[model samples]
Target: MSEAPVPTGLFSGITRLDHVGIACRDLDASIEFYRSTYGFEVAHEEVNEEQGVREAMLRVNGTDDGGATWLQLLEPTRPDSPVAKFLERHGEGVHHLAFGTSDVAASAAEVGGRGVRVLGDGPRPGTAGSSIVFLHPKDCGGVLTELVQSAR
Candidate 1:
């Protein structure tokens, strides 16, 4: 068997792992757990009505360089919300992995061009004023993937 060559420029804009989204039944409890257990501190918190999630971004360690990776705790605000549906199906655990990108729209287009399914028509509003889009799990090795362009 022969190995296939890696494609170029498919994820050129991806800079780093931005955050790991964890679906939770209670946002406050999850925050407290991470705080007491791992000493992680909340960096930002917001309720995104469009996504139907009350989310908090926790800094794993200290944010000395202003580029610390975050642990995003997401709690559903409604029964029909995506977080709620994920919790119902998989219980409390990781929901998605977000990668930091310099340009989400361009990155999504580039990846989509390679046959990976982009979940929406375009990038949408994300936490902390960032723009985000999800790549379909079926095309992403069964793990839901998110691309985030941090607010500038």
Candidate 2:
């Protein structure tokens, strides 16, 4: 029989905050806001149809010194999509925070054991062809959290 997966203790296995996802009513406005307020630089941009949203990655300035980490802006393609719902409810703000982990499935399982609810039972394909999993907001202190395995 295959051995059961082991949980890493309290996300300690995670090394850093990969990115922070923000659901925006207006992608251009949010991008401008981040630029004007924080001077972040755009690193990547793509439209993900499977996720039904368009996204952009903005590298946080001085992140090596503990400044703002990478920021992701998500604009929904449909009004019924999750990002749209989030905007309707929260009014353009941070949606989730992604953590960089070596083994996302193991860390997710560990967090699940602690009564945290993960969106998926296991890792799944995400934007840019990366593996990822989302944790329920209730378990993350009201913040939706995504665990992402590096593309490397």
Candidate 3:
């Protein structure tokens, strides 16, 4: 006789929409365009060596009052980076949708336990001082998804 198992909700741990990840060939150009056209200012910028990407986060509403989403523009630093591969295959567009969470590892584990295909196995370092994980696009209806737990 097998024992009963606990159940977990997928969206329970997620807090809010973190941002949309956009892969582009030129990070500075994309940042400039978003800033000049949409008034979205760069909130944070960094190069994640682990991920091999130069990334910038733009505040969509131009104010970091909390309770807002951002736009993450990613420029690959190496040809093997995920963003670079995405650019080669799809050519500069939305790469992934990230959701904010307090516990990225737990969120990723819960999703994985539910038989969802998760990329990178578990949580790893992300830009903007966060831990993150990506859910495979195929499992997420062709939309690459990410879960982020901020250092803040």
- Listed in order, each prediction's TM-score against the native is 0.89, 0.81, 0.86
Ranking by lDDT: 1, 3, 2
**lDDT minimum window of 10 residues, candidate 1:** 59-68
Model 1 misplacement above 4 A = 1-11, 61-66
| Best by the lDDT measure | 1
Over the stretch 72-131, how does candidate 2's per-residue lDDT look in tens digits? Answer: 899999888888888888887778899877788888877788898989558887656668
Instruction: Report, for every candidate in turn, its global Cα lDDT versus the true structure.
Output: 0.89, 0.79, 0.84
Model 2 clash pairs are none
Candidate 3 clash figure, as a count = 0
Ranking by TM-score: 1, 3, 2
Error of 3 at 46 (Å): 0.2
Q: Which scores greater on TM-score, model 1 or model 3?
A: 1
